[model samples]
Each structure stands twice: as C-alpha cells, then as structure tokens.
Target chain A: MKLEMRDQPGQLVAALQPISAVGGNIIAVIHQRETPAATETLDVQIVLELPEGRLSRLLELLREQGVSVVRIDEERLLYECTLIMIGHLMHTDLSDTVDRIDMTGSAEVTELSLVMPAISSPSSARITIRSTTREEMKKAIRILRSVAEQKDLLIIEPLEGA
Target chain B: MRIAILGFGSVGRGIARAILAKNLDITVTGLADSRSGIIDPAGIDLEAALSRKDNGGPCGSLDVTPADVVAKADYDVLVEVTPTNVDDGEPALGHIRGALRRGKHVVTSNKGPIALAYPELRDLAATNGVFLRYEATVCGAIPLIHAMKEGLAGNTISRLYGVFNGTCNYILTRMAEDGLTYEQALAEARELGYAEADPTYDVEGIDAGIKLVILANTVLDMRTTLDDVERTGITLLTPEALRLAEDQDCTIRLIGEIVPEAGVLRVSPRIIAKSHPLVVEGTLNAVTVETDLAGDLTFIGKGAGSVETASAVIGDLLYIRDRHVQGS
Candidate 1:
C-alpha cells in the first residue's frame, strides 16, 4: 500500500510507528528532502508491505492518531486547489494562521505567496492548498476565517452568483 | 454515504480507483453495467473487481447484473459513466434522470446531456432536491465548474473564451510545424491517442462547441443555443495558411470565444498573438474568463485525463457529502 502523507515535522515518524506496530514492512519511502519550489509541503508517498487483512485497521489507526493522510491505497490521487485571501494576510501572524489550517490534517497549505502593499496597508495572498476532499477546503477556509477575525482582517471569498 | 458507478468504462474504473485510493468515508454501494448494477452496500473488494475486469468479464460479472444492481440498491451518489451519443446523451441521460428521480445525487462526465438539456435537467435536480455536478464534461480535471459555481458566483460574467479542443489544436500545431497535411496531422494525433479514431467530434469543433454552450449559459447567465454561435473547425485551414500564421508569430487554435458584444453573444475561433498567455500554454487547454468585478482570470491545466477527471468526481462527491451533513 502507498500513502501520501503531508509534509510536516514528525508526520513521517507518526505515520511509521502505526504501520510498524502492525508488523508492516517498509518497502520504500519517497520523501524528497528538498521542499518543492511552489508548495511548502512535500508529498511523501510511502510504500508499505503490510499484512493483507490488517490494511484497513492500519488506515483507521493512522486516522485516529491524527496523521495528515492525503491518500492511501495501491495508487494515490492528489488534488490541489488555489484560493486567494485578501485583507491583512500578515498582520494576524501569517505563520500561525497557516499553521491552524494545516492542523486540520486533511489538507496543508502547500504554497503561500503574499503580496503586501506599501505603507503597511492591508495585504492579499494567493494560498495554494492540496487536500483529499472539498470538505477539507471548506474546513481550511473556516480556519482561515477564524484567524482573520482575530487579526481584524476581512476575508473575501470568490463571489457566488445570485 | 454510499456510492455506485454505472458503466465500468474508463471513467467508472478511474473513479472507483480514486475512491478506493483516497479511503474516503463513503462506502462503495454498487456497480452497474449494461446487464445491471451490482449492490454491495457494506463495502466492496476493489482488487477482486479489477481482477474480474482484467479477465474480460462483463462489468457486473463480479457479483450481479446492472438491472438487478440499480433496482436492489440504495445509494447516496450514483455515478453514471455510460457512453454518450452526440444526437442524444442517451443511456447516460436515462441513468442520470433515473438516479435523480430515485433521489440520488448524480455526477457525470457526459457532455451531450448537459449541453443539450441542462436547464430541464437542472430543474429536475432542483425539484428532486439533489445536485447534478458535471465538472468533467467541459475540462477534465480543471475546476472550471467549481470556479463558476462557487469562486466567481458573485460576479456577472460578460464573456468566456478558450482553446477547448485539444485534438484540433494538436493537429493544427503539427500541421503548422511539421508541414503535415490535415489528414497527416490528424493521423499523427490519432496515433498519439490525442484524437479518437472517428475524430469528427474534435475536428468538427462539436466537442468544444458543446462545452462553450455550457460555459456561456452558466458564466454569462445567457441562454445560448448551439445554433446561435458560428462554428469553424480547423479542418478548413490549409498548410499554407498555417505557415502564414507561423510567419506572423501566431498559432491557429480552435478557440471557443464568447463575448457579449453590445446585445449579441459571440463564440468563434481566431488566431491569438504569440505574446498572449494562452498561446504560451501550448498543447494544454487554457480558458480566460472575463467577469464584471474579477476582471480577466485565466485557468490553465491538463484539460483531459481520467485521473484528473476522477479528481473532479471526488470533489463533487465531497461537496454533496458536506451538503448532506449540513442539511441533516
């Protein structure tokens, strides 16, 4: 089985022990040390030789342990979505803001490009995130909205037709 | 949530792989083919299904037939991936309408039904209180459907344009560069798996034209008919004309351009300047949307692929799931 785990500190270790506990053999790990140029997180596709019957149990155990598991199966499908966040992207502690959304474990803010204006004005940013589902995207947006509220920055989503 | 895929072809098989690979919360409820749909609500063994398909068995040979599968099944999502006829999105339309009628959310990649009968079908969805997502119809893997449905919902789109047909563009570019005749370029494209054996849909611009109608209706909020827009296929371009385009530093692209000029809506093809961003995207389909507030925004990506298209299916699945949760 191959699983794409979001790149974060201790994610690899966390994902390993559960499989190792189930006596799964580690075939190969493809975690490039160098971060991707566009995204902050790397897609770590781990190939594991686990017992046939224990695969589902291993997946459940990983989910219970809060691993940011993107996909898990023979072959994985990765979906990436780009969203633009306007208003004081920096004033609200951008790193903390990003971290909160990353904590969802369903998705990670893979890429963040901030465009701050001169004279300390409000900022807008294009945040490219990858997730397994659209629910994760909405969850990420909710997390961003909470952080933006604390920073008093207005969050504007793409307008919907009436 | 439970999911079922009818017609285990490229799309059905690809979506099945996506769902199993992702290990999502939903369970595989059923699989329907010509014979009938197979229902296994608890969960399905994916490897076994693939093995059955590999052995040249019918789609539902794993467990049951398609007729029995749909009748004896209860699915939250019914994915219809049947082959579509240009004249009528047929069997697929029947499956989708049946699914919606049965109160199941329908998702499909079939463009024929959507381009021909979206308004009437959408009205049915509204009446049935279900969703009908067809992101894979226009541009596979690209989130154009989501972009219009959610991202730019507030803005009134004035016009939409893009290089929608990959086969035509590939043939044209090859004709321009390799000096191959239309037939030769089309043969190369067919050999490369870019164009179908009967490349009429791609070459005649019908495929792109259908997608253009969908985009125009949704984005511009205009009710456009297939007859309203003037269509010209790349089949008309000669090697000499393509050479002239090259001399002028422009590429001949089968562009599905829709602009609201005064009171009329226009969708047609024309040469784009080399400096244009779309020209640089080469081979990859790109769409530039002009909106009232958002201005001009361009989305570029792999417009066709089973995996990418499957990704869109998964997205719609999650969206419908969330809505189900919220409504509950």
Candidate 2:
C-alpha cells in the first residue's frame, strides 16, 4: 500500500501501528524523505501481508490516526460488493453508471442484471462489483451513490459484510 | 507454474525442452496441436509427448482443439506458437484472446495475431489484468522488444531501422557477395534452408512488414497495420543495384525504417553505408532504435531458430513467472 502522510514526527510510527494491530505482517517500507512527483506530502510505500478481511479495519484505523493512503496494490484488495440501483437507470444513462465503476482500476462490475417492469417505468439493476479490498468497494459504492444523487435516483447498496 | 503450449511445432518443442533442461518449476499442464490436445493437472511428460508425436501419433485427439486446452487447462500462461496466418491471424488470435479473457497471461511467437489485433488484444489483456508478451514475434532471439520496452524504458524512442527478416537478409547477402540475380539468390536461400519452399512472404517484404508493424505498435506506441507499412520487396533490386551500393561504400539491405516525427513507416531495399549498424551480413537480424536518453541502440542476433526462438519463449515465460511471483 502507498500512503501519504504529513511529514511530522511519529507519523510513520503511527502508520505502522494499525497494520500490526490488524494482524498484518510488514514485508518492506519505502519511506523516501523527498517529496514524490506532484505531491506535497511524504510518500510511504508499504509491502505487507494481511489476513483475508482485515484490510477495511486497517484503513479505518489509519484514517482515525490521520494517515492518508495514496494507493494500494490491486493484490491487497479482496472483497466483493453487489449494488442495486433503483429508478430511471436508462433515462439517466446506465453507461455512465457502469463506466464510473469500470474506470476505477481498483474495482470492476463483473456482473450486471437489469429488470424493467414496463417501458415507462424505471429500471432496477443488480451490479456485482469485485475489488481488491473492502475500502475500494466502498469507494465505488460512494461513486454509485453520487451518480444516483445527481440523476435523482435511489441506490440500494449491499448490506454490511454481505 | 502451470503452462499450456498451444502449438506442438519446433518452437513448442524447444520451450518444452528448455523448461526441462533448465529445471524451472514450470509444468506443461496442457499440450495441443492443430488437430488435438492433452491435459494433465500434474504435468505432461515432455519426453513421452515428443516420442509419441514423432511416431506419428496425434499427441492427444482430434476432438480436443487448442482452444479447448486454453479454456480448460489448469495453467497460468498460454504459449502460442502456431503457424502464422497473415491474412487474418485467425486460430492464433482467437487462442490468445480466449486466454487473456480467462485471466491467463499470453506469450506468443505468432506474428500475425499481434500484427493485426494488437490494440484490441492489448486492451483486453490490460482489462483482464494479465500480460501479453511477444518477444519471439520479431527478431526471434535478439530480445529487441524487451530491450526497447523495458531495458530502455526511460528513453523516448525517435526512430528505428533494421534488417528484420533473416531469409530476406540471406538472399540479399548472397546477391551482394556472389553477384547473383534474384532467382539465383532465392535458390541459394532455399538450398541453405534459410527460406521456405514458397518464399513470397519473405522475399516480397510481407514478413518484414508484419514485424515492422508489431514493432511500431509495441515499442513506438504507434497503431499501424501490415497495410499501413509502405512496403517494397527486395525482389525488385538487381545485382547492379548491389554493385552500385558497394561502389559507394554502402550495401543494400532489406531495411524496415520508421521515423515517427515524419510519420514514416516503410520496408524496402535501401542502400546504407557499410559502416552502419544495420549492415550485418548473412542470416542475422539487427534493429537500431534511436532514443533520446540512451542514444543509438543496436541489437543483433539470430532472428529465427528452433532453440534460439525458444530462448525468447523461455525469457517471456520467466518474465510472466517473476511478475506473477512479485504480484502475488
């Protein structure tokens, strides 16, 4: 995982805490002091092996400690999220909805099914999204919600830990 | 690492032997030819397979095709070495597409598939999150693609020129040295086993054109096809042309040149100074890539052979292995 943190004292130590707390094993840490390209903060790249489902908790812990994650390798993400969008999907451009998810390299909508009650009525789509981690899936769901909000529609996201 | 060999020709056999001789942790889980296929999750016995095929056995069965092995085999990669069909890159292109779509990395020597459908295939591989490597597709054993793409990754390539087709190079060399006409040079090439019985593809510049298209797309980040290359075969040049070049301290080589700034891509019999990097003699392939950071880089080696091309296949296999290991 790549992270950006304020170049403050103990920030690196603070970042390491959540990883170990979530049953993660650190493999390497590339903490170069110089600012990376087009970024104001310090770049800390961590290679780690964590258990199957603790990545979300790790991200939460890091967020609580005020460490900003810049990127995560696709291998580290291992979670699935299936979302259902309700209302005027075709009118609002379903392509945009799917494109928003597919464009994100971290997540992909692998399966999608649509149901339309009538020609005039709105459609409901069941979109199955797979990501490398739970946080990435949530980020996609957030994008879906924003798209739904802009189009004056309703989004029924997957249940917690489903 | 599990590997599936989609073609059982010389290249396929060479890679199988290299894997065994090198004692890599790779296993041939699936093997197939144009007519049939066989699969074993544990591994296919290379020696037995070779002997069986050598004895005129089908190797597997006519019912199970190469596509079936690619789809059903317990393998991480698909090594595509089938005969090239420049007309449309069928069978080979379909095999590569199926493998990439199934989240399997592809390593191929069949130039037609790459030459014709590179952009689509490249996007498919990226979307499916797998690699598509074709080092043996151009300049068989010279490592030109890897050298330009990875070794000189930092530099911006400006132009490229080279003798890409060994058969054509051999014919041209004979024409220049022995002062033979086109027919005589071609006959010599066939006698020396440098060319196929029907050498139209090599002698007519289509083979070099395909290789040039592959290079243009892969390394130069240009999207061009076999049709886009302004091609002129070496058959048109005469011994007088060769002698004229020699008098000017130059030699005529079947050269493929690409000047990206001018948007120029062509393959023809061009006269270059004898001192030029592309002026290699005999059945050797050479490519000179002009780069901003690394200056002029020239790569020369045997462009085609059973084992030499197999060396490139091994390199690609290990490349996929290392990337897989690192990613996983």
Score every model by TM-score: 0.63, 0.65
Segments of candidate 2 deviating more than 4 angstroms: A1-162, B325-328
Which residue pairs collide in model 2, if any? A77-A132, A77-A133, A78-A132, A78-A133
> Cα deviation of B50 in candidate 1 (Å)?
2.2
DockQ, all candidates in order: 0.01, 0.01
* lDDT (tens digit, per residue) of candidate 1 on A84-141: 4545566667888788878888778888766554546556565666665566677777
Q: In candidate 2, what fraction of native interface contacts survive?
A: 0.00
Q: Report the error of model 1 at residue B326, Å.
A: 8.3
lDDT of 1: 0.70
On the 0 to 100 scale, the lDDT of residue A107 in model 2 is 84
lDDT of 1 by residue, B303-324 (tens): 7767777888788888889887
TM-score of chain B of each: 0.91, 0.95
Number of the top-ranking candidate, with lDDT as the measure: 2
